[model samples]
Target: MNNDFKNNAIRGPINAFMFKVLSGYMDRLFGKSKRQLFRNHPETVVEIGSGTGANMRYLKPGTTLIAIEPNIHMHANLKKSADKYGINLEIKAIKGELIDLADNSCDFVVSTLVLCTVKSPEQCVKQIKRILKPSGTFIFIEHVKAQKNSILRWIQNIMHKPWHWFFEGCHTNRDTKQVLELAGFSSLKLVSYNLYSPFIPIVSQIRGRAIK
Candidate 1:
């Protein structure tokens, strides 16, 4: 087998396992905000980086979810969660940066903690903009860089490299708010807050909607 493939084969399972184990705790930390932000989702929705269906609980029963999750290791658990939630799941094993969906075809696009891990946040946002219908909404909840010159920011800088490697490219200090602002959304509403979690690097978070 190719060395890269071999590495991924090992890393993928570990990451998936970690997500599974921590999903509940994470939900407890962010669930309220997610619930508020995920309200009134369309019947059909596209989710970028839908790992293990962490957002499934917020979706209504019988919702059609097109999940873009590249990590095959997460598919089985994701499917299980979809079934539990009564979601009509369509798994697309693809990256967020280059979605296969046609332009202007999606009514709603949902993402949770995704921008911090995608290879290119700019390209992913551009793709999201391209696919969303006129006046469509892109809802998101993402962890981002802490206040400048703060203890959390210092910790994020110190732990950046190891955390990125261990979490499979999840950046501890991405300026996702700025990214969304520059993405040219017709209207954007974002609220920043600190999550009181043991995971210090990811405590700084923002959640809101951006209209296309």
Candidate 2:
């Protein structure tokens, strides 16, 4: 499988279908906690890579949401989901690296399962930091590189290229936590956990907030 197949075959229809099936479970597992992290209702919220608007349902009342989704194929569903959920959303069909917002414009930035696939993760973070208010918050949930010397770690290394090709440029082993911290977040907080399965062992995960 190549990048084309990954985007057309896997990322479009299949990815949307899979999300439809798994979103409820995902919400139950992690979405609630993420919502709690933003309970204070930021006036301006920007969710990068808001695929199908899964996070739309979690937005707090009176928040003005900017949903950035680079893929055109996902836009319709994203709009439908936002409308269905009654969210105050503005859709932007653009990449995270070129966020069409002014400096210090947004109060909160969010990314969930998105950093791994962005063309330049560091650039995305830099843009986020640029647009965020001085006291703004950046919240993220990402699957990352496994523990050193572990079987899963070795597997991730071995499958790196193939996995990227199969999953629309998603790297299985990015050190995204460190990337965010290095991107100049003022106060950073993150925690790691694992989701082990027969097919994929020790799938490492991280979720937290970085205050700018």
Candidate 3:
């Protein structure tokens, strides 16, 4: 527990409410496409910044799971989520972009709403790409700057400060979709979208198969 109060306390409730909103619309939000992402579950799934295990419900059984979270304060909750779901979750108290995992060792790497806060998301993306075995996939669900209306952009910019104060480093203006692509995601399957009061706003889930 690295004392990420930004997540455990302040952002925690926000995260809970956001998930509650999504839990209701999960089917329509994924619309069978999530199945595609899970079809070839890797032997081990390395998830970066797995906050309080909100993703537990989506995990398939028997897969080895490793979660990277720097916030010591929120570690327990993340562990609890895994236990509740019967997931074999491993915790890395350090950053995900610098996972101790050997190069090309993991079959899959994932991140969920976790990238926006990374001090260096690009480096983390590179590390994810580097650690994944050849042809491995990186699955992610993250909030990014909207591609649709500019009003959303304006709103994000305006509320960005309060959002960060409440949720640690969460930013409302990152363009995560483009980041993944630029970081070398050749194939992309966007899973869902929705507007916001929560910056969980219309996320773009990336399930990219490494071409190298």
Candidate 4:
């Protein structure tokens, strides 16, 4: 196992359990948007940070889903969900910053709420672009920083440390939108919205696709 993977063993299981428990509620909050964005995804798609396979429900049965998940603890539940969904699941115990795919080898890549947790959002997005076939799209839904000078922003700043610690390095105020825009995609389309959930630190969210 990678050192990073081993180091996270203690917190990894706790995070995995939390995601498993909250998967249904999260789906309820983001299901519609996920369905809209995931519609007609290719037969084989790559998904970054596929925790507990929460997005599996949005994919068609028999779809080939290559899940990039670094946390070993999430794999068991993720596999269970894949079986339930009839997906052809391939698990890669790797981080998004260093994907092991060939250049232009993938047609589509998907991510949901992953950017905030990656060690380097820029490197992750770069890897996404590198592996995508020309004109291929990277679909994503990520929580971002609340507007500057807003009360919510203040709360995000205050809660940042604890949130990061509890969530295994998830940033409470990551500027994911900016990272995508600067990734040099051929074209990008994004929508910003608030998820009216109790998780206020992650309420400000964005979802869209960037074409390579």
Candidate 5:
């Protein structure tokens, strides 16, 4: 693991509790999208940068689920959470840019609130594409840069520096939608949107399926 992945969490108890609360909300929300995207069809679903397995419940047990999480600190929680559900969790301390999974092996690929912090977003998407089988859906729920009221962009840019420093690669202003297109993800169907993040005017909730 790298130094960035081994950094200690300085999050306060209150902050930690809030993180869990928000995460639980995402799990519950994504469940519907995940179910609708697959229509209850069981398939191999792999999630890149699965932080602490917070979204595990959204995945069906019959679906083959695998995860790649480079952060060692998050893996502890990932394991604990996986055990709680008796889920088959294959976690690795490997970067999303450097995933080591077989190409075209997964029926679907997933990501959640992860792209904002990954080092090589393009490479990660390319790797994800390679691993997904034909017509494999890439389910995701991420906060993206806003289009209206340049106010969001201004705020994001102003707070970007300290944000990245403290959060280890997080960029509040990452143009996630553009990046996804650049990575060749054209099959997109946005499901929802939100405007409240720790510090951002526009946060997006999206659903996209890769056209393999």
Candidate 6:
């Protein structure tokens, strides 16, 4: 296997375990928000970093779902999840930074817990803007850097390197909300929230939509 596959192989189980451990709380916190957004009922949707197809249940039937994910090991689980959820799925083995779709081809672009992990959050948002139709919506839920000068913030800064290595490039301190605003979306609305983490308050998150 190649280096990329080797890396994915090593990280995939960890990711799976992490998700399993966190999924209950994650679903509880964000499940209603996801359902409400998908109720808008966009026909063509593109989801970035669709790990294990966790968002599949939020989509409406007959919706065309374009799933962009690069990790080979996640594909089987993702496919199974898609099938179980009855999603009209189209899988793309690609990264967010290098989306291979035509401009203005998507009605809705979605990302869940993924912005912090992309190679370039700026580039990924740019591609999201590029692929979205003029009136399309971009929906996202992302972890972000905590309040400046706080103890948790300091911990996030100190732990950034090891966290990146262990989590396969997921940055614990990304200001993802700022990145979305600076990406030049026509209208942006984001709300900062927190997940229930036992150890630290650094699990600061933002979720909302931007119109292109």
Per TM-score, the best of the predicted structures is: 4
Where model 4 places Cα greater than 4 Å from the true spot, the runs are 1-7
* Whole-model lDDT per candidate: 0.89, 0.77, 0.67, 0.90, 0.66, 0.80
lDDT of 5: 0.66
Ranking by TM-score: 4, 1, 6, 2, 5, 3
Go through the candidates in order and give the clash count of each: 0, 0, 5, 0, 0, 0
Per-residue C-alpha lDDT of model 6 across residues 22-50, encoded as one tens digit per residue:
76666777899888766776777899987
TM-score of each: 0.95, 0.88, 0.77, 0.96, 0.81, 0.90
What is the C-alpha RMSD, rounded to one decimal, of candidate 6? 2.6
Which of 1 and 5 is ahead in lDDT? Answer: 1
Q: In candidate 3, which residue pairs get closer than 3 Å at backbone N, Cα or C atoms, i.e. clash?
A: 1-72, 2-71, 2-72, 3-72, 194-202
Worst ten-residue run, lDDT, model 2?
A: 1-10
lDDT of 1 by residue, 109-199 (tens): 9999889988889999999999999999999999999999999999999999998877878899999999999999999999999987789
**Pairs of colliding residues, candidate 4:** none
lDDT of 4: 0.90
* Candidate 5 lDDT trough over 10 residues, lowest sum: 11-20
Model 2 residue runs over 4 Å out of place are 1-10, 197-202
lDDT of 4 by residue, 1-212 (tens): 13263238688898899999999899889999999999999999899999899999999999999999988899999999999999999999888888999999999999998899888899999999999999998999999999999888898999999988778788899899999989999999999988868999998999999999
Model 3, position 62, has a per-residue lDDT of: 62
TM-score between model 5 and native:
0.81
Models, CA RMSD each = 2.6, 2.9, 3.8, 1.7, 3.4, 2.6
User: Better model by lDDT, 2 or 6?
Assistant: 6
